[model samples]
Target: MAKYLLLIVEAEEAYASAGEAELNEVMEAHNAFAAEVGALGAELLGGEALQPTPTATYLRKTRTDDVHIVDNPAPELKEVVGGYYLIEAPNDEVALAAAKRCPAGFGHVELRPIWSFG
Candidate 1:
């Protein structure tokens, strides 16, 4: 079996700026989707809602063995990676199916293959 990462991106400020009722509804939708994914026998390894983009840090390496670190996300955008799920699935198709059902709140879900050293 292979493990996949379902990265959920969202506009943190936009979400937080919404009305209380709207925020509640959005959260409910996400929770419901998570429950559905769990029912499919996919293991939810771990996930967390990240702090706003302002708190993010970026790092890069150069050919001369130089490393650069910055205090911003790469390709700045209104939406940033808010959370993620590590799941075991039979194939990419199954992982994509789950990603499609994620409640992104006008954002996006990126499905990436997890690289295993073993």
Candidate 2:
């Protein structure tokens, strides 16, 4: 099986002021997604929600050994990676199908196959 990373990309401002009920709905949807994906044979290795991009630290690297850690990316982006799931699937198609079922209510999902060098 191969590993895939489902990057949850979304606008941070939307969730920043989410009402209590809205938050509950999102949590419930996530729970349902977890159960549904597991039934489809996708093993969720690990996943987590990240802090806002405002809290992100960007490491800028150069060929001449220049490196600097900044608060965010060089060109600030509107959408940020809010969360991610590391899943193991039978193949690329299966991984994609699993990602399609994930509950990314207000935003979209990005599925990428993890490169294994061994």
Candidate 3:
């Protein structure tokens, strides 16, 4: 089987304004999506929900050859990666099909195959 990563991209404010009930609903949808992927013969290897972008830290090399560290660097970005799922499937078709079942609510899913040397 081949591995794929489903990147869950959503608006930065998508979850910030969500009520408790809405969050629960979204979680339930995610549970159903996971089950559906399994039913389609894909193995749900791993996944996680990320903290908001404001909690992120970034490191960059400046032109002066110095490493600069910044916190909450991209709050201006309208959309951010909210989570991801690592899955193993029989082929591209299966992986793509499983990605379609991901619960991305007001955003979208980006599916990329994991590179393997062996």
* Top-lDDT structure, candidate number: 3
Put down candidate 3 lDDT per residue, 27-93, tens digits, no spaces: 9999999889988889999999999776777888866678898766666767789999999999999
Query: What are the runs in model 2 whose C-alpha is more than 4 Å off?
Result: 62-65, 74-76
Q: How many residue pairs clash in each candidate?
A: 0, 0, 0
lDDT of 1 by residue, 1-118 (tens): 7899888887787876799999899889878877888677565666667777767767777555788886664666777788877777777877778788777875889899999897
> Which segments of candidate 3 are over 4 A away from where they belong?
62-65, 71-75
Candidate 2 lDDT tens digits, 39-97:
88889888888988777777878555788776555456667789988899999888988
Q: Candidate 1 at 94: error in angstroms?
A: 1.4
Displacement of the residue 110 alpha carbon in candidate 2, Å = 0.3
List the candidate numbers ranked by TM-score, top first: 3, 2, 1
Which prediction has more favorable TM-score, 1 or 2? Answer: 2
Model 1: which ten-residue window has the lowest total lDDT?
Answer: 70-79
Off by over 4 Å in 1: 59-76
lDDT of prediction 2:
0.85
**Any idea how many clashes model 1 has?**
0
